[model samples]
Target: MSTYIRQIKKNVWKWKNENGIFSVKKYPTVEQAEKIRLIHKELEYMEKPFILPIIESTQEDFIIQPWYKGDHTVSYRFKEDRKAVHLLLSQIHDTNKLVDWEDSNLFYSFNLISKWQNRKWKMNEISFFIESHIGWEQTKFLLLCGDIALRNMKPFNMEKRTLLHGDVVHHNFLSDSSDYKIIDFDLAVIGPREMENILWMHRVLPEINYDIRLLIHEFPHLEKVVRRYKEAMMYPNELYREWLYAYSLPKERKQKFIEQLIPYTNKALTEWPNLCYTLSKL
Candidate 1:
């Protein structure tokens, strides 16, 4: 019998048996499965120095891939994992070819500006509630940063599109033995490479205490992008995103998140001006 391991999300689960471990994802339409198969095929063709799950089988509503044995990157050494992830991302972008998405709309083009604008509007709508919880000064600072980020960001260029992994959180990276592999393509889309890089930065900067210089030093390739889109780096996207998410949770959970968030929010408020100045000089 298969032993239940853990729930990956609402409808996905991990299971183990004599054959070894595997992931069973439920509720994917046939079209969705086809898209994932296509994406996996493309990645396989590239033969990059990373591992993606090999789909063992698929049913009408479920898909299975043999479990990769490893911890998420968060449990590994950050510096090494970061370097590997960045290199893998570069390879993925380098090998990108236009996908024939056709009628499925499984992988749509990313519209950076439009998405940011919508986020800005959502933040505004909930500003009063957020301000009531976090005080006016903190809320104002986040909103200001959002405005500046939007101002500095360029419109999406359709010509420079590539297949983006979409979600770059450390949890999505599996530290398999000596190599890192990316997983969970639920949010995958066609977008500018910079969009993925920006999200990766948002996820990692907090770990480094928001030091832009060190970040660029670690990844020299990012220097040009950082200099070009200074305000986007300066924006407190993670803080704002967390606050917005906290607003959606139940009262107890929201309160717990707010308690944890206060220090992070304050830290961002304190460092944002200095970050802006640093970016300006870059």
Candidate 2:
């Protein structure tokens, strides 16, 4: 173990001489870390590379295998390696990694509400944001995607619950000549396979030129579910607010960002009805 630490950012440190990378996480319990480690070993044995190759960690701190010099942006280039990306995600979702893992995807469900409440405990201000921006009326309709899927679509029709990387934001994916890999598993857990794909569809699709039907063909059972989730995505405002609110900023600056997002969110909402209908016919 390297005692020398080079600070890369807040709470994130790099081992000297490119040994590895480490970060201090705020949640996912010590037990979850252990499970992640177990999954890494399993992936290695199965000839799949779990990018989050955990080197070692305690309750709050964990290390990852060092990444090579390459493009780490999570973007449309993923389309270039679509088969590899789908293989990686499918292998992950299909495997039974651990038992009693928490659900990480926020699909429409009572389970998601429970997880939201738990998350709210940590980010108390999010509750205020939710109340002021996404009130009960919105929350009720938020999971319509989940409801439609569970009611109409069959379950995963697999042996084990799908494990999710949770946060599929593009930056979490790294690319090189060989393939793409995922990082940042602090929010990793078991959940619906569609939920993860849905995130990729919204977060990665619009930025790229690839046809989303490629993803649909890969997970045909999840076609409608994926469409529903995609339709529900409230752009810039809802998405940006969620992403930006986490940063430690001055109160005034944060409020400014929120206010600026209102028009964009309203525009998205205004277009959603027509968009929703279009997606429904798909």
Best candidate according to lDDT: 1
- Model 1 lowest lDDT segment of ten: 95-104
Model 2 alpha-carbon drift over 4 Å, by segment: 1-4, 18-29, 50-52, 56-61, 76-78, 81-84, 97-110, 113-160, 205-224, 227-249, 252-267
Q: Lowest-scoring 10 consecutive residues by lDDT in candidate 2?
A: 104-113
lDDT string, candidate 2, 1-282, tens digits: 555666666646666444444443333355555555655665666665747455555443254555444554445554555545655777777665543334433222223333433433433434445447656554334333334423343334333345677776666667776667766665676666765665556654444322455556755765777555543332222343352463356776867766655554455444545544555667
Clashes of each: 0, 1
- Taking all chains together, the TM-score of candidate 2 against the true structure is 0.61
Query: What local lDDT does model 1 show for residue 75?
Result: 29
TM-score of each: 0.90, 0.61
Check candidate 1 and list the clashing pairs. Answer: none
RMSD in Å for all candidates: 2.5, 6.9
